[model samples]
Target: MVFDAPPATASHSWMPSSPCGPACIEPIDEIGTARTLARLAGVIGLVLSFPVLTAATPKARREHMQRRYARTALRCLGLRLRIVDHRHEPVDGFAAPDTGVLVVAGHIGWADVLALAAVQPVGFVARADMVDWPVLGTLAKLTRVIPIERARLRELPGVVDRIARRLADGQRVAVFPEGTTWCGRAYGSLRPALFQAAIDTATPVQPVRLRYLDGDGNPCTVPAFVGTDTFGDSARRVLRSKGMTVEIVLEPRQWPGTDRRDLARRCADAVRGTDPSRHGLLDTEWIAAGSTRVQDPSVGERGPIRRTVMATRW
Candidate 1:
C-alpha cells in the first residue's frame, strides 16, 4: 500500500495556494447572526438525535436519518448543494448497498466533510487528531468516522484495516487522499496508501470533485481551511459570503482488480480536470502529491466537467 515511489507527507501537512483563477473572489460578504444560530441549532438537534439514531434497529432507517440530517444541517448553514452524477451505474437512493466501495474525493476545506455527508450517507476517514475537536469531534466519533494518525506511518495499515472492515461489511467509506487541502484551481494526486485498502478488500473506488462557488458563480475563496487558517476564520468566511454553492461532480467507479496505481492516476486526472490524452502526470507522482494550479475553468463558460465524464458501462 505504498502510494508512491517516494511517499506523501503526513496527514497534517498544511499547504495552501491562493486560488488566482477567474472563479476566485475577495471581499467576504458577512452573513447575519440569525443564520449562524440556525446552523448551531441544527448541530444541537443532531447531537440530541444521536441516541435514537444509533438505537434504530434497521440500518436503512439509520442511513435515511443521516442523509436527512446532513441536508438540513447544510441548509441551516446557508449553503446550497447540487450533485451531478456521472456514474454509468447509479446507486439506489435508499437501498441497503453492498460493501466494498470507497469514495476518494478532493480535499479543500473542513466543509468538504459536511458537504459529502449530505450528498452520500457514508462514514469518513479523517485525521486522528480531529477526535479532540469539540463539537465536530463528537459528531465524527458518533458517526463512526475512522481516524488516521497522519504522522504515524506504521498506523496507516491499522487504519486501512478498519476501513477494509467497514467496506467488507457493505459500507461506503470516504477519504481525502490528497492528505490535505489544495487550491480549488487544480487537483493533486490521490495518495496511493489508501488505494491498497480498496484492492485488499476488493472494493470499488469512486472519485468525486468538490468545489465551492460564490453568488456570482466564481470559486469561493473564503471557505478554504488551509495552512494556518483558523477554524473561526474559515467559518466567518463561509458565513460572510453572500451565497456558497457546493458542486459535487461524481466520477465513474473503478471496480475491483483494477491496478491500484491506475486507479490513483485516473482519479487524480479527473480531480485535476486534465484531458486524459495529455498524460500530464507521471505514475510515481500520481500517488505522491505536489501542489500547483494549472487552469482557470471560469474564464469562459466552461463545458462539462471531465471528472463527471459519462460512460456506458460501470
Candidate 2:
C-alpha cells in the first residue's frame, strides 16, 4: 500500500458520508501478536542499552530510541503518520526546549494516539483498566504512563497530581480532553476541566489537530470511536480499509496565564477552525463562543477494546 503526503495548503474539504474509493485494508491481524513480541523485544533492547541512554546527562540516546520504538510500533500496525510543521526547531546549537508541554490533541480515531506517539517521548493518560493488558501494559509503564480511573471521578484529582508531577519533571503529558474518540467528521467539545492540572502548573498546552486520509491522500474514512469498534475489528478494517494517512498539525502552545476555559476555547477553535460543523457532530455549547465544556457522546460506550497499545515514532 502507498501513502501520500498532505498538501502545503492548510484548509481541506470535509468528506461526505459516501463510501470512500476502493478499500485498501490489509489483513494485519498478525500485527497484534507481532506487536506484542516487538514490545517485549523493545523492553529487552532498552535493558541492554540502559548504559548508553544513561551515559549522557539527559539520556538523549535512550529517549531517542523510545521515540523510535513508538514510530516502529505504529508502522508495524500498518498505520502511516505524517507530521506537519513542528512547533519549534533546534537553533544556535541548542535543542528545542521541553517546557513540559501539556499536549492537548483532538481525539478522533484510536489510531490517533499512534500518530501522536510518532512525534516525541510523551506521557499518555490512559484508563486504569488498561494496565492488565499484555505487552502494552508493560510498555506503558516503561513510558511513565499515567493511568486514570475513569469510573470514579473522585480519583481524578490524584491522577491530575501525578500528571502535574510528571510535567514538573519535564515530561510532555498528552491528554485526550474530549475524553473520548470519534470520526474526523465529529468531535466532542474540549473538556476544560482536563486542563486543570496544566493550569495549576502553569504549563503551556500545545494543541494538535489530526485528519486521516486515504492511500490517494483523500479523506477515506474518519478514524473514530474505537471502543465501539473492537481493536481486532478496527485493525482488520484499517488494513483492508485502505492505506490511511494521518495529518497532524501542532499549533502554538497556549500559555498558562490565560483562563482555563478560554484556553480550551482557543484550542477548540484552533483545531476546528471556523467550521465547527465539519466535524460530523459538535456539542451544542461547543459552537458557542467561549464555551469550554464539551459534551461527550460516548461516555458509557465502553467495549472490549480497552487496552492502550504503544506506537514508536512513525
Candidate 3:
C-alpha cells in the first residue's frame, strides 16, 4: 500500500533530499516464483507468530525472541546478514548492558530496522505512523519503538528527552540521524538533534554502517524503500532478489563530548567511512572489495580493526 508522504514544512528544512530513484536500483539475479512464494509465506507466518510469542514472555527472553525473529525474517527474504565489528570490546549473545548505548546508522530502507535488530535487538526511534501499520504496527508496539512525528517539529525535544531517559535506564536505543532513507549507494548527513540524547546522558554513540550487497559482494539497491515506493514495492523486490546480503559494519563507539553537532559529525564520519564524496557515498570499487577504512578524527583514531561475524541461518 502506498503511504502518504508527510507534508513538508520549514521545520524539515534541515532534512536532505536525494537524487536517487528507481533508476538507481541495479539489476540483480532473482529467485524463481516458487521460491519467492515460499519466502513470502515464511515471512507471513513469522509476522503472525511474533505478537503471540512475545505477549507473555519476560523482558530478557522477549529480547532474545525478537533477535531470533528478525534474523529469521531476513532469511525468509533470501538475505544473509554479515557483521563486521571494529570495536575494541565486543560481546557475544544477547545481553542488556549495564550502561546504555545510542546506536546510530545510515538509513537505507525498512529492512534496515530488521537487520539492526537481528544483530543486537534494540529499541528504535521510528516515524510515528509506523505504529498504525497493520501487523508491523503491532510488532512495532511490541518492540517499544519511540515514535516521532516528523510534521510536528515542536515535539522533537520531548522525543529527545524520552531517548535520554531510556539511556539513563541502561537501555540500548537506535536512531537513524539522517531522518530519512537513502539508496545504499548514497546517504545523507547525520542530523544532530538526536545526538543530544547521548550527550545528555553521557552515553557512547555506536555508529553502524549498513550496506545491501549481491552475492558477489557488489552493491544492491533492490531493497531501497525510497521516493514514492510503497511497502509492498520494496518487499517484492527483496523477496525475489537472490543472494542478497545485508552487511553491518560496527564502528568504534564514540563517547559523547559536550557538543551534539560535533558528536553527530564524528558518528557520521565513522558511518560514511573516509569516502571524500558529496553525501558521503562510497566508491563503488572500494565497496566491492568488501573493505573500507573508518576513522574518527575527534578521537585521533586511525581506523577500526575488522572482525567478521557470520550469523548462522536457522
Candidate 4:
C-alpha cells in the first residue's frame, strides 16, 4: 500500500451528519484477526532497529527514520491519514526552533498519537504507565517523550516544567488537552498550564482535530481504546475493520495571551464540528439559544456522499 503526503488544499466534501449522539459505537468482530496480526508483525520487524539507529545516527537522519517508522507502521496497519488545513500550508518539520510550536489535539485513542507522529515528529505528553509498555515504552523514552505520573498530582508541575523546557529547547510538543480520553463526539477542556508555556515563550498553539472513519465515511468505532478495551483488543479491532481513514483538521491556530479556558472552549467547539471561522458562535451555544442550525456561510455546498464520513465544518 502507498501513502500520500498531506494535500496542499483543504477540502472536506465529506461532511458528517450532525454530530451523532454522545454514545460512540465500538465494533467487536473477529473477522480480520489474521490480517491484523500479519500487519503487526511487519511493523515490529521494521521498527526493531529504531533504538539502535536513534542512538547511532545523526540528529536529522534519526528524526527522518522515526517518521518513516511511523508512516510505515500506519500503512502496514491499513490506516489512511487525510489532513485538511484551511491555510493549505505544508506540514512543518521540527528541524530546530527558538521556542518550538505547541500542538494540541483531541484525545481519541493511542493510535491517534501514531497518526500524528506520521505527519510530523512531535514529542508528546504520555502517561507514566507507558514506561512499562514493552517495545513501545522503550521507544518512547528513546525518542524523548515527556511522561506524566498521573497518580501523583505534585508530579504534574515537574512534568509541566519538563514540557516547558522541551519547548524552550526547540522541540514541537503535542498534548491531549482533555487530560483524559473519551469518544470522539464529546471533548474535555484544554489544560490551561501548558497553554501558558506558549504564552511565556511567545510560541504559537496549533489545534489539530483527528477523527477515524471508514471508507463509507461513517465514524469507525472499532479502534477506540476506551473502557475495558486492551491494547491488543484495539489493535485487532482496527485490523479486522474493512479499512480505516483518519481526517485531520488543522484549525486556525492562535498565539498565547488568549484566555486558557476560552482557548480550550474554542478548540473543543472546532473539534466538535462547530468551526469558529465560518460559524459565529459554537453550534451548541446556538442550539441552546434556540437556533436549530448555525447557518453555514453560503459558499461551496458539497453534495452528500453515499453514507460518507463528515469532515468538520471547513
Candidates 2 and 3 compared: the better one by TM-score is 3
Higher-ranked by TM-score: 3 or 4: 3
Residue 139, candidate 3: Cα error in Å is: 1.6
Best by lDDT: 3
Show pairs that collide, candidate 4. 15-310, 16-310, 217-308, 217-309
In candidate 1, what are the lDDT values of residues 1-314, reduced to their tens digit?
11111112333323222222324334546677787676667766776776677687487577667777777767766789888887776475312366557888887776788788887678889876565654566678777889876666677779878988888888888898866565464445566778777888887788887788878887665666554455555655665466778888887777647577777777776666652211112222221124333333444454432232111111
* Candidate 1 deviant stretches above 4 angstroms: 1-25, 52-58, 93-96, 256-258, 275-314
Per-candidate TM vs. native? 0.76, 0.67, 0.83, 0.74
What is the C-alpha lDDT profile of model 4 across 19-50, one tens digit per residue?
Answer: 21112444533445677778878767756877
Candidate 3 ranges beyond 4 A from true positions: 1-12, 56-58, 93-98, 276-314
Residue-level lDDT of model 2, residues 168-253, one tens digit each, is 77778888776545455545567666677788888877788777776677654535433334444454455434365778787666
Off by over 4 Å in 2: 1-58, 86-98, 278-314
Q: In candidate 2, what residue range of length 10 has the lowest lDDT sum?
A: 13-22
Cand. 4 Cα-lDDT = 0.60
Query: Model 4: C-alpha RMSD to truth?
Result: 11.6
Candidate ordering by lDDT (highest first): 3, 1, 4, 2
Report per-prediction Cα RMSD to one decimal: 9.4, 11.3, 10.1, 11.6
